[model samples]
Each structure stands twice: as C-alpha cells, then as structure tokens.
Target: MTAGNPTPDTTAEPAPGPESHPEIPWERLSARMVWINLVRLVISVVPGVLATAVLDTPTGPAWPLLVASAVGVSATALACLRFLSTRYRVTGERVERTTGLLVRKYRYVPRDRVRSVDSSARLRHRLAGVRVVHIGSGEARSSFKLDALTAATAEELRRELMPDAAGEPEEEAGRETLGPQPGPHEEVIARFRKPWVLYQMFSVWAVLVVTGPAFGLHWLLQPFGVDLLELVGELVDYERRGFWWSLALCLAVAYPLGFIGLALTFVMSHWDFTLVRTTAKGHPVLLTRRGLLSTRTVHRDETRVRGITFREPLLWRWLGLTRTSVITTGLRQGPDEDSAAGVLPRVRMWEAREVAARVLTGEPSPLEAPLRRHPRGALTRRLVWAACGPAVVTGVLFWLGRTDVLPDRAWLVGVGAWPVTLFAAVFSYLALGHALSGSYLVVRRGAVNRSTVALQHRAVIGWTLRQSIPQRLGRRVTVRIPTPAGERHYVLPDASTRQALAFIKGSTPQLAAQFIGEAESGGRRAAPPP
Candidate 1:
C-alpha cells in the first residue's frame, strides 16, 4: 500500500500488464557462460601464445608465455561479462530481452509469434553444465536466443515458450524429469534401432555421407599444410592405369571404410533417440531429443507444424528404410533446413507411418491414402530426360572423340551410364504423384531422394505456374505452391495444364478459381482426380 493511497482496495483487479504476472522477473544468463566463452578463447589463443613463447625475445620465453596468458584471461573475462548486461524474461504476452550497457537495446517477440523452442548443448557447454536455447519465429533476424542456461532451466523455458503441447498437469500427475530421457509421464513415439545402423552399413552410397565431412575438414586444414584429399587423389589417380582398375581400387578402399565410419556416426548420433509427445499450455507439442555426445532438443508447437515429409533415398528406399522429417513454420527454410527438422532417422516405412500418425493425432496416416497417378505424357517427359538425354550425351561424346576433341573413353563412359539412367527415370516416373487428401495437399517426386510431402491446405499462400519449352510443347505445366514453411514452395512437375489447374482449384479455391472455368470451357473437361 502506498503512503498517500488509502490502503489499495483489497479486492481491486490487478492493474494488468507486468503487474499481472508478479512471478516472472528479468532473468540473467548462467554464470557458467563465462566458462564456456573462456574455453573458446583459450582454444583460439593457445597456438599464437605457444609460437610467441618459442621465440627468444628481449622479454624472455617465460615472460612471453605469462604475459600472453594474462592478456588472454583479461580479454576473455571482460568479453564474457557481457552476459551480465543481458537479461530476458517471459511474460504472459511476450518474450523480451534487454541488452547493451550504454545505449540499452530492448526487443520483445509477442507470445503468439514464437514458433519453436530449440535447445542444444555442445561438448564444452556440457562440461560447463549449461544449454543454449533458441526461440525461432521462422524469420532469421527476429530469432532470439539465450545462451548457457542450466539444463533444468532450459527445459522449463522450452515448456513455457511452447504452450500448445498437450499433456497432463505435472503437479496433478506428480511427474519429474530424469536424466536425458523423458519423464514417465511423457509418451515416446519412436526410438533408435540397431537395424537402422545395419541398413546404413550396407548402403552402397554411404561413401558420400562419410566423405562429405572429411572433405570439409580437409579443406579447412589446407592452409595448415594438411592436404588429405590431395593424398587420396594421388593414390586413386587413373592417369597411369586403366580407369576401371583405379575405380575398382577406390571402391574397394572406400566401401568398407565408409561403411564403418557411417555406422559409427549413426550409432553415436542416434544412440538414444526419442520422439516424445507432451503438452504445453492447452495445445499439443512434439518434442524430439537425440545425440550421444552433443545433445539436441527440438520443441515444436503442434499447431505450427504444417506437414510431414517422407524422404526415401535411392539405396535406402531399396533397403526398405525411409527418413522422416516434419515441415513446420517454426523452422527456418534454407539449404540445410530439414537437417534439424528430422523427427525420425531412416526407419522401416511402417514405423515411420505409425509415428507420423501419432504426431498428427490421427489413426490412419494420410500417406496410406491413394494418390492420383500422373498422365502418360509426364512419363514420356521423364523418359526423354532419362533415356534420350543420356543417349544424346553419348552421341555427342562419340562425335567429339571422332573429331579428336575428347578421349574415346568419355563416350564409352556415357554408354555404361545410359542403362542406369534409364532405370532411374522409370523409377522416378513411377514415384510421380499428387493429390488432395482431406486436409492435406500431397506432392511426391525426386529420383535420387524420392520425397513425399503432405502439406496442410490452410498453409498454402498462393500458386505459381511454370512451363519449359518441352513442357509447353507437351501441353504440360509445373505448379508450385508457396507456403511459409519448408521450402518457401513445393513443386508438382510436368502435370497437364488442365489437371494442374484443377488441383490448384481443389486445394485453394480462389487461386485457381479464375483459371479453371476458362481451362474447362476451352477444351474437353479433364476427369476429376479419382
């Protein structure tokens, strides 16, 4: 009660705003963030510090080492202390952060705008016993992060930010979180399996997954005089020998080693994978936690989840394993956007479907629904690219070899690849499909990585029509749907103009409403997708 104000009316409703939630206050980042930053500083300074200490200067070896050490410590301590200036809070209406000492920067995201609550902890941060939290709203610049929070606090914040996850009240059920796994109250939808490891081990294309990172590391170390890729190239050089022999030798060495590396990585990364269903606020949320050394936790509000993608790579699809990822507005779409969005690693198709249904809160998964097959012209278009395209390349190489422009082996190589290309084209044609499944718009395509995505009808913002010279000649058009989630747009390639327009109209009426009547009245009305 204020001194002049007659004791504030006891029953008066709270004035509102910040006063409405007295429990929440501006919170500071964990002090251990200083340790995490210091570790990074030491790692950066050690090499230079050692080189300086090795030089015999007027300041002596010991003095250089000691002085460099002192400077590093001072700089790190001051820089990391910026955590002291940072403060954030979660109010009923917003998630706010305040930073900067002199100028004072304050920013807040409305509670409704928060899309995902993701938390991760690297090895050093784990050693310091802290996790970093990110609250993303699809947009890159608007994302807010909290670094170095206690594991428990990070989990609490994750729950607070994602209010739509459905679950029973913890107080009523008397549940407590244990270790890295979900508490007994949380329902786990999927987990790691040994067969997944073996499936990857037997994969003929595993070399790409294993060597991609090795090549990146080798590139980074090139300035340091490390040339691992060059060494590999020298070993596999085919200039002095038959290309076939060199190819065989390279395959022999890469296959077993690639298998072991990929399997080990698979085991280490997904040793304790778990996809759990939990509740926040009144809505349901999907929470996925995995990894052995560096743990990652992705908390996505069920409402923001626009769809699911079932991706089947060539070899994995043959091996009966499929990779599953969710399409959510909370996740930013970019080159590697789906990497962190994967809800399940490669697993049996049925297991993937079951988990999809569980997360989607439906008994019969949408993937089970029949899809409208593409017209024969689409298949003809694929055959031209798959068969004639390679045949044309082979003919060009043959002509070039006769003209002394390229080696005879180039044409021979094209001959050898023609059959495989044709086979792939046929498989891709078979996979081409699209349909409107109740509340979802389904589009499936791709040969190397056959991906079938089920997007919500309401998530579609608009439609785009594209046609190439060949497509125009064949009277076909490619339709792309623009959405805020996944890849800004999803594509339906080489469908008849009439059918594509019909699909557009079926998914979202207004976009195609203007085009449909004219298209149908102009020609024999296309049969509605069965």
Candidate 2:
C-alpha cells in the first residue's frame, strides 16, 4: 500500500466493471518489494561470503564489510528507482508493463496471446508475502515477468487477464466483466499412481542424472588433488583378485547410490502431480499443477493443443507403460517445460490410449495402421555409418599392436563392437516407420528411447517433401508436416508412388485430390523417375 492511500480490502468482494473497459488504472508495484529485493540480495551474498572464507582473497575481513555496504547502497538505489517507475495496467484486451527512467520501456501482450500463467515463490519471497509471476506467450521464449507482487494482487491480475466468457456472452459495453462464480464443471480424467511415478523414475533423464554426477564427481575431485582412479586402483588389487571382482564391487557401490538419487529426484520434482481439465468461461482448458519446492500451475487453452506423443522406452515397453505428452503451440519444447506437454507421465498403455481420445479427436489409438517400413537400402546406409566407428577403432588398434604399445588381442575388441553396432543400426532402421490412423498421422522411430508422435491432420497447415539422390534411388522421400506447435517428419523409405500419394491426400484430401487425380490420369508419367 502507498503511504498516502488506504489499502484496498482484498478480502472484500470486488465491484464489477464494464465488460469492455478501455483500461484499468495503472497499479504501482508494492513498496514492500524493495525489502524483498534487499532480502534476496542478502541471501545471494551469503555464497560469496562462504567462498571468501574458503578461498584466500586479497581483500581482508574489512573489505567484505565495505563490499556489503557498496552492494546494499546499489541495491537500495535501484529498488527505489524501480518502485517509482515500474507500473502495470490491465485492459480488456491487453496487459501492459511500463518501466525504465531514461529511455522508458513499454511491453504489451494481448490477452489472447497469453498461454499460461505460472507463479513461484522463493523462501524470501514467501516470507515477504510476494511471488514472482511469469506470463507465457506460447513463444519459444517468455518476455513478460512481474518480479514481486502481493499474492492477492497477482491473483486479481490473473483473473482480470482471463475474462469470464461465461458471465458475459459478449464483451459489449454496459455489461459486467466479472461475477461470483463456482468452480468449473470438471471430471477426473486421470490421477497419479505410485507405480506410474516409479516407472517414470527409470526414464532417460534418470539414467543421466544418476550416472552423470558419478563421472562428474570423479573429475571434480581432480581439482582438489584427489586422484579417484588411483585411489580405486590401490583399494582393489587386480593381481591378487581378478579384475572382474573389482569391476563387480564398483558396480555394487555405484548402482545403489544412483538408484537413491533417481528416486529422490522423482519424488522432489513430481510431488502432488495432477492433470485436470475444466471449462473456464465456457472454453475447455487443461490445467496441470505439480512440483514441491517450486509449485507450478499451467492453464492450457485446449484449442491450442495440436496433438500428442506416446513415448515408450525399450524396458518400459516390456513393462506395459507409455508416457504421454502433448504437442502445443503454447508451450516450449524441452524436458523442463515439456511437463506442460506431458498429459500422462507413465501410464498403462491401454489407460493412456483411452485418455488420449478425450484429449484429441479421431482414433483413440493412433498406432492402429500397419506402419510402412523403410526400404532395405535405408538399413544398408545405417549399417555403413555404424561400421565407421568400429573400422576406425580397428585401424587404431592394429597400429598400436604393430608398435607393441598394446597386445594383438586389442584389435579383437573391434570385432565385438561390429556386431553390436550392426544390431543397433538394424534396430534403428526397423524402427523407422509411419502410420495413418483416422485423422492422425503417426511416426514411430528411435532404437533405445523410442518415440511415437501422433499428429492431428486438422492441425497440419502445410507439407514439404524432400528426397536425396540416395533416397531417390531407393524410392524414399521425407515428408515434413508443419503445425503451429512444431514440425514433424516421416521417412517413407520404401513407399511407392501410390502410397506417397495416399499419404499426401490423407493430410489434405480436398486440396491434393485434384493434383493426385491428374497424376493418376497421366499413366506411367505419374510414377517417380527411376
């Protein structure tokens, strides 16, 4: 509250305003935000103080105090300027942020472009009764952020930005903008089960999180003058006991520790995860809320979602688990923000497909059709590339053996690498496949971390087809489907002219039928050149 004005009673019901008001009065950020900023600065300074204590700095103890005073004065001045200049206003159509002293910065976002509103509070912010607000614009990056605002003010701002379409049929003049409303009529689509989270724990991220740190720790210890490899070598004598015994001991110690870290990561990140769909202002919106320390709430406009992907790993496939994620124009594509994409983290295959129908139109199971496999030539190409590594390794080993640097048996390792690489290459080639199920075009690929992306035909706006000289020889063409969410491609390695025509017509039958018919009437000329 400003010193001169009375604080608005936040608990009291807000008076309704005109549905098509030009703008709300510009609201200044709380003056208390200055204190919050100071507190945050102090918290960040603690790490520097601790580092100085550990490392011998040229500056003495008095230098720390001087530095602290300088920082405090700088922060205080900046906070004063920020509190005075920064102001935000919400209108019927847009949210505006006006700040900066000299040049003046004005950021504006139309309400329709706003995709999601995320709120988070650090310990200091929580104590200060404020939270940082993030407004996502469905872009690759977010530009609007409200650094510190009172919890009530933030909620009020969010509500104003999201007008009640249910209350007012239209945003005409002389109509109320907001009204006392009950929660939206929402049904439980799916809830998180412990078994599902357990399955999610064994994901690709878990493998990296568990083992990456172990290797990193070994490297990190080197800077401290501790030789990890030398210590382990001294502890386990290969001469007295077999090398296999020492290797087994290392695995026994490392794996359990990895599992512990994996479990803890899963619990911390996915605590109280829930997916709920409810109608807001008569429009269906999907809400996903989760996280322990940093809780996140994403309100997705259901209309913006383009499609979904059912990701199945090799081990998870055998266990009958499939991870479901949404492809939305409103959310960024990455693991961290991808949770906004995740409809179901890890669910029974049947359960996932069942829920997918509600989330999307057309066939519930998008992988219904028999996928058209790539040509054998594609497999041969993959094998050639896969053999390159083994070939290089074999050459190096032979050179070493000739120089007496390594035993002759070292070259034999390349022979073992060959079969493994061949198997992997074949597996990857076999996995290259695509299907057309109802209104969805599905593409399944990958060897270890298999992903099956099902995109809605209605969501597709354009198609691009490309064929290389080698791919052309094999009658293979890559078709890229572009949507607002992202671009997804299918490799039709062995497809005949008819199959390729059918695939194109499937996406836009009305648009492509004329061209396809003309080609068909042209006889052999329609067929791709040999």
Q: Evaluated with TM-score, which candidate comes out highest?
A: 2
Alpha-carbon RMSD, each predicted model: 10.8, 11.3
Clashes of each: 12, 0
lDDT of 1: 0.71
Candidate 2: the clashing residue pairs are: none
**Candidate 1 residue-wise lDDT, 185-270, digit = tens:** 67878887778787657776767765787766664444345577777768888677677888788778878888998789888777
Model 1 misplaced stretches (Cα beyond 4 Å)? 1-33, 37-112, 144-185, 202-254, 332-340, 386-405, 408-417, 468-473, 505-515, 523-530
* Model 2: per-residue Cα lDDT over 1-530, one tens digit each: 00011236678434333233544677788767877777667765653555455535333233443455466667767877877888777776667777889968777666767755556676777778786776667553334777778888777766665554655322211111112122457655676567755665554444456467666555544434556677877788756778899877766666666666877766676677766777666766666656667555556566667677777777788788887777766455545324556767677888887777777754456755578876677787789878998999999998999899999779989878999989889878877887788878877787766777777777666555566777667766666665666333333444445566678788777645435555557444442221
Q: For model 2, what is the alpha-carbon lDDT of residue 427?
A: 77
Candidate 1 similarity to native, TM-score: 0.68
Error of 1 at 130 (Å): 2.7
